[model samples]
Target: MPKFCFVADLHMFARRSNAERYQDQIIKTARESELCILGGDIFDFRWSKYLTEDETAHAAVEWLREFDSQTNHCQVHFLLGNHDDHPELLERLPFLEQEMKTFEWSRYYYRLGDSLFLHGDVADKTMSAACLKLQREQFAHGSRTELHNRLYDVAIKAQLHRLAPPAVYPCKRVAKRILNYMDNIGHGRETGIKHVYFGHTHRPMDHYLYQGIHFHNGGAPIGDAPFRILQRTVSLNDGENGLESRIRE
Candidate 1:
């Protein structure tokens, strides 16, 4: 009955030239859909340290505020990702809280006519633990120097060069193993959820069935062309018996 747009892994810091254009596209997408779901990694990395209370951070905050205003009519749900450190980024702006909701390392078991919407990160317990540990360490460190940031950037670029074929993590075997293990538990036999949507792997895949469950990854919005699903639900009410169904694209 309600239509929503799902997007994730924007990696907003990766490219600056198209930042405004990307924001416009997101706003447009949100306007088109009744709701917009952000899968995570929306801010690129822990922004508080580098940005401080400076103009850069303020500008970024304003952009988000404007974007939220543009999508005031649409409900926005944000699932925490490895890259999003500041959950209170939008709280500084008025009326933004009503339009957007942010979750911290949690899973949203949304049931819309027997269809489930999951952010995918909740599927992997081990990786999630590791990522949390890393985040905690980063937070405790207080701030990173410019040199340290540059060095880390170099290391990431080097790693990317080595892991070109997969275009995601360097080791495909490890990646698959981690994903498989996560999928096994998150969608365990007892969950009873029929359809699930998630994004973190940045790979555009649909109709992948694991065990007895259906899995769909919406992919990243930064690469290729942004892709989202439009779902329609049909409900049948018959006195004591009710039937609900969904169709997605």
Candidate 2:
């Protein structure tokens, strides 16, 4: 059983003290776990909303060198979240240059064991109060490419190309809508996905079970919680554990 640390939505910015803290957390977590998975939004481009373009870029990549330099002992996997502009990130961050290997980025989602790891934006789009079910149904047959573009539209592209700052995620509405989505998506799909871990909700679910799928929302630093640590045998809270079985599984 491998140990993994799940953190998301750091929305890292240019403050010296903040950058230092982010680096410390990464290095420390890496040393303690088999791997550290930074789910998304590692860089906060939302600063562009208020800062000059150059300032935004500088602040976004301010601590990359030091952060990258200290990761020799721990393996880190980067997944581009809604806030991260993948192409721009590689160009701006020297450590993420094509030659860099110790730290790599996954354009799409990652898979490990029986779980599928994504940044959680896919389910985000259809989460509004109206047409939630209809939206998911409409996108049911859509390709991952299409879904990516749509999700990006809401998460980033629509907000003046600026990502959101840390906000209390998994708000009551988001949580309930997401749980409904988990029910509709059919947890045991071709990938045999019993669990899906995604960070981006900024809401630390700790554990949310719905429709046979174990949904873990890795909360961000938007509020009180810094991060959540997950081990192989961690037990999930069963608020509605049997609900999934009643549905299908």
Candidate 3:
């Protein structure tokens, strides 16, 4: 069985992020695991502390390089989130993919057997998969202005983003929407997908069942929710008790 470590929404480079503080712990765990999935928002281009977009892009690439160098012992898969999907950074991924042997990236989702892993923004309060894709497209193509970054900094300092707890616990609506989106993308139930692991709601969930699919979310370190690293021991039998949870201190 392959051991997997799943984490998301570290939001590195953002003024509000403490990911740098947790770097050692995260890297140590990733080095120990057979596979590590960085679910997304690992870089925060939208709320970056950098003065310009180009600077943020450069810093993000260098950050990736450093992280890749440290975790070369294990397979690290980075899935881009809305916050990190800037066009400038996206253009540089292929070169990094070639330079880093143990690291790879995906814009959408990664699947292994009956389990699917995604950044989960596709289901961010959307009613239809089409709307979800459209929303993602807009975010991907959008550029953040200095004014926008400043406003985000103020919002973060005010802790405005954390004011509202997620309306629903376990987020069944998101799980259902994710399933529908998967169906639209031809990676649905028919394709043997039985479990989903995602991030973006900043809500932690473990083994929550919706319409026969088990959903898991690690939650983000920044949000009101507790940060948990999801560990999965992959096996051929879906009924096996192979999922483990460790709360990151």
Candidate 4:
């Protein structure tokens, strides 16, 4: 038996993030868990308070190093989200992944047993998974000017990001595309993947099932929407099904 912890969209190092407030608790829970999934956007290089993108990248690595040291008993899996796909940080991730024994990084997703974990940025209505991944890869290798970064910060602070319509979950189209993606990656229905945990939409969902699969999201600690750290426990030897639940502060 092993316990799993999931937290996402903390947007750590962002100019106006509330992630710092939950730092201690996040570390405490990760330290206690057998596996910790840092769902995505754990670092917001776009809104970082650091003077330079390079400086922010350096700080992010140090934070990961400290996290690795503090959670020696836990396996930490970090999935990159849109905001965390900075070129500088992307370049450093491979090295960090090699340096830390318990730390792993993925540009796309991770599949464990009957569950799947992804950053959820591939849920667009028109784009195919391959297209979306290629677009993200292009963005990761792209550099942003200071002026462009400032504009992005201003737009976010103005809540312009919320102008888009919210997504309706249990969506058949999106679900089908996700399933197609899993099939391409060789983790389709045959793998017994019943649960999906993701972030990036910032909307939290718990065990929402559609087409025979369950979806769970640990909402971001941003804006006014409900948010909490998600926890689940399961026994590998017993072929058990785990329940997704939120941890209250």
Residue 58 C-alpha lDDT in model 1? 60
| Highest TM-score against the true fold, candidate | 3
Question: Each candidate's lDDT (Cα)?
Answer: 0.49, 0.52, 0.75, 0.73
Candidate 4 RMSD computed on C-alpha atoms after optimal superposition onto the true structure: 5.7
lDDT of 2 by residue, 1-249 (tens): 467676667766512113334556667766777666777666665432324445555655554445555655355666666565434454565455444555555643555555555666655654432343244234322113445545644554354222342343434444455545444544334435556678766556655665555777755553233455444422223332222121100
- Better candidate by TM-score, 3 or 4: 3
| Candidate 4 residue spans exceeding 4 A from truth | 126-129, 140-174, 234-249
TM-score of each: 0.59, 0.59, 0.83, 0.80
Locate the minimum summed-lDDT window of 10 residues in model 2.
240-249
lDDT of 3 at 211: 84
Pairs clashing within candidate 4: none
Query: In model 2, what is the error at residue 148, expressed in angstroms?
Result: 27
Q: Which residue pairs collide, candidate 2? A: none
Candidate 4 lDDT for residue 164: 33
The residue-by-residue lDDT of candidate 1 on 135-247, one tens digit each, is: 43454212356777677567555654224424543233333444454444453334344445666565555656655555666555443344454333322233211322221
Model 2, C-alpha of 186: deviation from truth (Å): 12
lDDT, model 3, position 231 = 83
